[model samples]
Target: LERIVADVGAAVVVCEAATREKVVAAVPDGAVVVAGDATPASGGEGGFAPMVAPDLAAVIYTSGSTGEPKGVTLTHGNMSFVADSIIESIDMEPSDRILCVLPLYFGYGLYQMLTCVRLGATLVLESGFGAGGRIVQLLEEREITGFAAVPTIYQLLLSLPGIGEHELPHLRCLTNAGAGLPTPVVRAVRSAFPDARLYLMYGQTECQRVCRLDPEEVDEHPDSVGTAIPGTEAWVEDEDGEVAAPGVVGELMVRGPHVMQGYWGNEAATDRKLRPGRWPWERVLATGDLFRADERGYLYFVGRRDDIIKSRGQKVAPREVEDVLHAFPGVRDAAVVGVPDDLLGEAVHAHVSAEPGVELEAKALKRHCAGSLESHMVPKRIVIHAELPRIGSGKIDRRTLAGWSPRG
Candidate 1:
């Protein structure tokens, strides 16, 4: 936190009572501290000026699951464009009440707040999804019309006993974007909240939102991340920098007004990601994610470019393997990674957590994978855990898992 404050050169910080002392102690000398709930000081209107569209609005840092976090600099125009797109795409209204469990510092959670303010909708804040029962109760008591969560939170909600028995007529919209919600979890969520429309979205902090799958199309393409969001263009480009044919896996590229200006104090990294588009002045984000589009132009997430495993001389997408694992009877969540192997340049390895009160064996999971996945894609080794390790962003900590071995 101190490093972030120094890197961004923050002159002022807002904190609540709980964190006021710690925040004051850590902030750099001469930095102003203001209570988030305290009334503003008088006589501040003399020098105030309205912010312009091009002015920097927020700097949301990435999850840093892979390495050091990069600050994604978003302009007022970027945030406004995405907010409008979300309101239109989701058909959000002023009368709706949205429940936000994600951290406000994260892009996904921040957008929820921005959209609510834009439409004058009610924004219900929760510190965290403590338990499934509590979340369900909030949905019922708060009369939440819209809810957003990542796959991990959804997995926890589905694991709760009698989750489907709970009635939530007020839940009209469900959005998942941090990570792709497993196909099994998607179906289970729809079954539990039949009245709510589930939207499968895909995006990165560099670009607020690139695409979203319409609720009506979930069944037809449950695995797809759908088409580009309004006013944005998304496509897959191959190694040669040409648009990839449908079903051909490649890096996902996004072109739109929502792209970040650049990484804060990291020009090399910025140049690597945000490159010039067709026009000399235009820039497009080269998302470091692997994706494929169907003939119908629906996008499907393959895996992170750095997460792909080359085993037995064949490139394997961990998402494909993880999907099959998610479908297993006793499995609640799963993660797969590549391990150094003497025989096959790298071997496929996996870790999975089972549903509550269910016993899972590595052999049984291996058999399940054999039934669904190709021999090369099958996990050579499987480990069961009470719960998979996750980073702050709710994504599986693959970097931590990468160093594990059979001996350990």
Candidate 2:
């Protein structure tokens, strides 16, 4: 098949008939294209020697700071270690079935699939999220025991006109990641899927899952991202370069088996992200997030460290925007931040809260920001909110702001 001949070294299975033909046409000379569900009928022997190297398991693509996509090469050992860590921590069972809406291209989604396959459990896949109706239907029809998604999915699903608890009887567990979830949306999801275990997961493509929350402890510690996954170490480093104590906010650093080997073919980025021989895994992924751990070592993710803008060349954290907004007469919550611009490197963007029955004006909020924050920190654009978009795992859908609406 073309994939085989073109040095697409990974062993790819053709799930659909048309896809099979395409693979055959592409690499007709060398590929062993296994078609259909029946493995024995295709002259196949079990446990074929892994065609990939020990340092290669799956290559997942992700968007980086350069505005270009990059492929992250994770070894089989890298992936296997993380999978075992997840299984060991959560104690997955053979009967578990996850209703998977995540795309295969995502490392998290692929991890879910590989984890299921390795554990001899089933992962029910869906072609699309469709709507709350479709998700509700899938839960009943497929008897899905687990679910996982980003913040956007949650926002879209919760907006469905007709949804209730009866529709999600089989959803035993759920996970949220990709972005940080808003507190209100997280509360809403917990109310809807009360029976299902909810975990707020955090990770990057460089390293798959760095942390996972315990469901029972959600209400007790709504802001915390939970303890480090087994085989993972998380700590806050102070500005002076020492480990921070409990409740002291600082840069979050992680060293674990799940940390990636390196960015494919980019030594500069690889060296920047992965510190060699740092621990048992020999690599530690430096997360850009600022966080603090509780006395018990439960980690709380604050926000991105780079999100803070240097206004008038003076550093300003976006959390300050949210802090100021909450002080307003009627505001309950806020997500103040910066967006890229041609001239300013970044421009302030404020999405704020409104009191019940009180219409908040952009001009008024703009004045409020001007009074509360430095002139440079005042949001150039003000967006009033009835509700902000969130995804399934209860995170803000900041990507939706690409087409933000300006209010009077």
Candidate 3:
């Protein structure tokens, strides 16, 4: 937080009571530091301030999965556009109540609150997703109409006893983003919420939402991230910047009002991302993610261009292997990476954590994956760890694992 404030040259800092002194000491001289819970002055009138849609609203930092985090500048229009699109796509109602388990600092969690307020709905904010049973209890007690989470959250929820047996009639929708949910986990979610609509979404911090798959299409296109959201255009571009044909892998590009203005104080990076479009006045985001499109225009994530692994003259996505690993019974969490190998160029390696009291053998895991994954997609090596490392976003810290050695 301090680094971000310093980098952005913020004029004021608002924080909770516990962090007021720290924020005051860290902010620039003459910068105001206000308590988040402080009451307004008596003379102050309460009303909406006059502002234009293009005015800056907030700056969100990327998760820094690849390298240093970059601050994404968003305007009032950007957030408002995304919130409205999501509300329409999910068919949110004014009386709907949402249960948010993600951190408010993250875009996925923040949008839940934004959408609720826009629709005049209720929001039940939890600090984090605790034990599965506790979350189920909250669902039953609160009568939540909507639930939002990432793939890992659903995996944990499905691990709980009597998960599929529980009745959640009030939960009308379940939305997922951050990373693609495995096919098995998607099935588990369906079983858990039989009557609810399951929405598989794809996005980044730069754009709050890019695409959304309808519940009816889940069975037909289980791997697709769906088409572009309303008022947005998404496509895959080849190395020469031409639109790639269906089933051809290329970087994904998105153009919409929800796209961020640019990276704060990073013009070079901004130029690389927000580049020229078909028209001189238009700018589209060149997402560094690799993806493929179906004949029907549904998008499927391949992998991050930098994260994609080359082995045996073929490309492999870590998520694809990780999905297979997650399907094995008693597996709690899993992460896949490419390791240096003279024979295969880059060998597929997996690190998995098991549920408490469950024993996992590398040989058994390999045998389990052999049934589903292609021979080239199977892990060359498997390691069992007590827990998989996670960063602030609750995503597996692949960079840390990439350089890790058991001997060290």
Candidate 4:
């Protein structure tokens, strides 16, 4: 918290009654502090202060693949474009009641509220997705029409006992972003919420959302993250800076008004992310995330450029291997990473967890992978765990998995 406060150069800190002491201690000496319980100041003479599109809106930090949190600076234009794009893509209306459990500090959750305000839609907040039974109840009781969350939240929802029997006819749309859901999880989500249109989206803190797959195309292109969100441009570029041919993997690039202003107070990091585009004044984000595209221009996330595992002269995408692991029966969570090896350069290692009461054998999972993936893509070693470690966003902690002891 201190690092973030310093990095972002925060002048004023806000806290609740419970955290006032801790927050006061964390903030710098001159920083002003406001407690949630403090009395409101009387109205001043000045009217509403105007804000331009380019004005800074918020700075949300994300734990990038390196495990270092970087503050992403977003502007009014970026937030507006994203909110409008999402509102249109999901066909959200004023009557829609959106349920959100993701933390508001994160962009995905913060936008849910902004989008609701823009649409005049009712926003229902939940503390978290713990146990998920209460979420199911909230869905039915609130008559929620729209819901958005990461893939892990969806997995927990599906695991709830008697989830299928719960009728959620009013649940019109269910959207997944932050990470792509595996094909089997897609099918399961569709089955569980027959009435909701499942939208598989992909994005990062650098840009709130890059693309979203249509519900109709999900079954056919389960692996795809779909086309770019309305008005945005997303494509894969090879190492030579040329557009990668369909099926060829390259770093994903995003260009549009929705791109962030840059990282807060970090010019070097900002320059690294926002590179020169087509024109002198233009800048485009080099996502540093590797992806491949289908002939139809649908984007499929491979892995982070840093996360790819080179094994036996073959480049293995952890996401591809994870998808296969997700398809295995009783598997609830899976994470794969590259471990040092003498012969393979970097050997593929997977850590997986099973559903409650289900026993998973590393050897059996290896056999399962053998039937579905190439020899090089299969895990050289598999570790079974009660649950895979995750970051705040609920995505698997690949950095932690990569640093694990071999004996485990």
Candidate 5:
């Protein structure tokens, strides 16, 4: 927060009681500080100049897993387009009440609030998704019509006993993003909320939403991340800048009005991602993620290009191995990475966190993978951790894991 305030040269800072002192200390010498919870007194004329849609709205910083966090500058138009598209895709209504469990600073959580406000829907804000019992209680008490969460939250909920037995008739929809939910977890989610529509979405901070799988197609295209969301065009492009054929993996490209302007104060990074599209003036987002599309246009997220493991002269997607690991009955979380190997260039390595009281042996896990994975796809080394490191957004910290060395 201090760095951001300093970077932007913010004139006023608004924060809650808990962070008021910190905000005051962080603000510039002449900057003003306002308490978020303080009631406003009667004032004179407060009208301000009208702003346009293209005007700057918010500057959200990236999680900086790959490198330094960059400020993503979003325009009012960008947010409005996203909110409207999501509202249309989800069929949001004035009567709908959304349960917000993710942090408001995260784009997913921020958009949830924006979408509800745009539709005049109710938003039940919570500090975070607490225990399964607490969340279940909130669902029943607040009569939540929709619920949004990342994959880890879903895993936690599924770990709880009697989760499938709970009846949440009011929860008309359940949405997942911030990372793909494993197929097994998807099944558990469906079983838990038998009547609600389940949406498996794919997105990034650069583009608010790239695609979303329809509830009806979840069974048939369980592994797919679905087609492009409303008002966006998504495709996979090869290194030569040509569109990839179905079943061929390539970098994902997204072109839409909802895309961010650029990374604030980083022209090189901005130019790398926001490249010229078909039109000379139009800039499209070249997402570093690797993906393959089916003949029907459904996308399968293949890991980040840099994260793809090169072993035995074959490019292996970590997501593919991670998915298999997640399917294991006792595995609660899993991450796959490539480690230094003199022979293979880089060897496949797996790090896992198991469910409480579940003891997973490396040999047994290798034996389990031998059945479903190809010889080269199986992890060469499997290390179990009490809990995998995660970022603020609840994504597994691959960067940290990539640098990890086994205890001597």
Candidate 6:
């Protein structure tokens, strides 16, 4: 955003605290300044004249590994539209207190911040999602009304020793994102939080969130990624370019106010995904995920495009294998991948991290898979690593850790 202000022939006005005071001062004073959490004792406004920009608001960046990260520029109209939509769909009230662990830079986390600010609710900011004890304590301390996290945190929290029933009663609800929750993890979470609402959502960074499974619909249709949020349009397009019939796999596409404008400085990437070609709307964000819709209109997840594997002319979903692996005793977490093969086009491989002191061996785990999975579906090899690879957001980076030799 600072770069955008400078490159767009405008100076950036920033507000910061003592630690960031030097950073903001470095910017040209010719730019308009606004103080955030760093105002003087009197709380007086800056002397500079306020400049108004219509529909345009600042962008927040998350691509930390990349050089010179750019912000996602969302207009005022866009912000108002999505925020109103979320508040309406979830029926958010001013009394709600959200436990926010995600930082403001992330759109998911930023929406949490915006929702709290707009609803006049309390935002109990956490340093991070490390374990359950701290969070359990905070929920009681702050009377937290809600929570949100990716699947990885769900697995960790579910596995924690003290996260069982009665530890957290004040939690009104919890949300999951970033990745799909394995069925086992989902069931485990249900057991842990018997009272709190559990919403299994599916979405990408390009679009904040599209589908959400409400708490009531969980038991009747736990696997279904709940119907599209109100005020949003959802359709699955097959390879033939038409709405997919019920029970048929298709690419999930979402059209709504929450969708992002485009990628930063990457017009081609934006054009590839956000094309308004066939959709009647002004824009649509095409998700790469493959999912099937049941006759009743609930969305059922299959797997990611890159996560599918083909073996001996038969297509296979790695998640199916991973799901079976998770059901096995002693297995803590697992990621399945397809490796190169001589007979088949690809060979199924399983990489797992087991519970501490569980005494699970490669052969025993293989036997466990053999009992549940078909002969063809069984993994040819299993690799157990000490720890899984993690990206900037602390979720598993499978591409980086897959195929690496297991820990001795």
lDDT of 1 by residue, 1-408 (tens): 787888888888888878888898888998887876786455466776799999999988898776678899999999999999989988899999999988888789999999999999999998877577788889999999999999988988888888888778788999999899999888998898888999999989999899999999998788988999999999999999999999899999999999999999999999999989989999999999999999989999999988889998999999999999989988988999999999999999999998889999999899999999899999999999887778766778888888876575
Candidate-wise lDDT, in order = 0.90, 0.71, 0.88, 0.88, 0.88, 0.73
Give the candidate order by descending TM-score: 4, 1, 5, 3, 6, 2
State each candidate's clash count.
0, 13, 0, 0, 0, 0
Candidate 5 is scored at a TM of 0.94
After superposition on all CA atoms, what RMSD does each candidate show versus the true structure?
A: 2.0, 6.0, 2.7, 2.0, 2.3, 4.8
Which residue pairs clash in candidate 5?
Answer: none
- For model 5, the superposed segments whose C-alpha errors exceed 4 Å read 21-36, 39-46, 406-408
| Model 3 per-residue lDDT tens digits across residues 1-408 | 678888888877778889888888788886777787786444357866788999999999888766678999999999999999999998999999899889888899999999999999999988778577778888999999999988768877887878878778898899999878877778778877889899999999999899999999997787888999999999999988899999999999999998999999999999989988779988999999999998999999988888888899898988788888988988888888888899999999999998778999999999998999889889999999988887766777888888779884
Model 1 local distance difference test score: 0.90
The C-alpha local distance difference test score for the whole of candidate 6 amounts to 0.73
- What range of 10 consecutive residues in model 6 has the weakest lDDT sum? 62-71
TM-score of each: 0.95, 0.75, 0.91, 0.95, 0.94, 0.82
Model 5: per-residue Cα lDDT over 1-408, one tens digit each: 778888777877777889889888888898777787785443458866698998999988877666667789999999999999999887789999999989888889999999999999999988867576788888899999999999889988888888888778889999998888989888888888889999999988887899999999998887788999998999999878898999998999999998899988889989999988889879999989999998988999988888889999998889999988988889989999999899998999999999978999988888888889999999999999999988888888888898898752
> Lowest summed lDDT over 10 consecutive residues: which window, candidate 2?
1-10
Q: Write the per-residue lDDT of candidate 2 for residues 1-408, one digit (tens) a residue.
A: 232234335344455555777766665454466666636344465856655436577666563332244567788878888888877666677898887777776666777888798898898887656466787777788888878777657755666655444666667787887765555667767877788888887787877888888988887776667888898887888787678989888888888667777766668877876655454647777777788888888888776786666555666667667656655666644676667777777788888656446678889878888888888888878887887654432345555653465542
Candidate 3 — number of clashing residue pairs?
A: 0
Span of 10 residues, lowest total lDDT, candidate 4: 39-48
In model 6, which regions exceed 4 Å deviation? 1-73, 277-281, 341-343, 374-376, 403-408
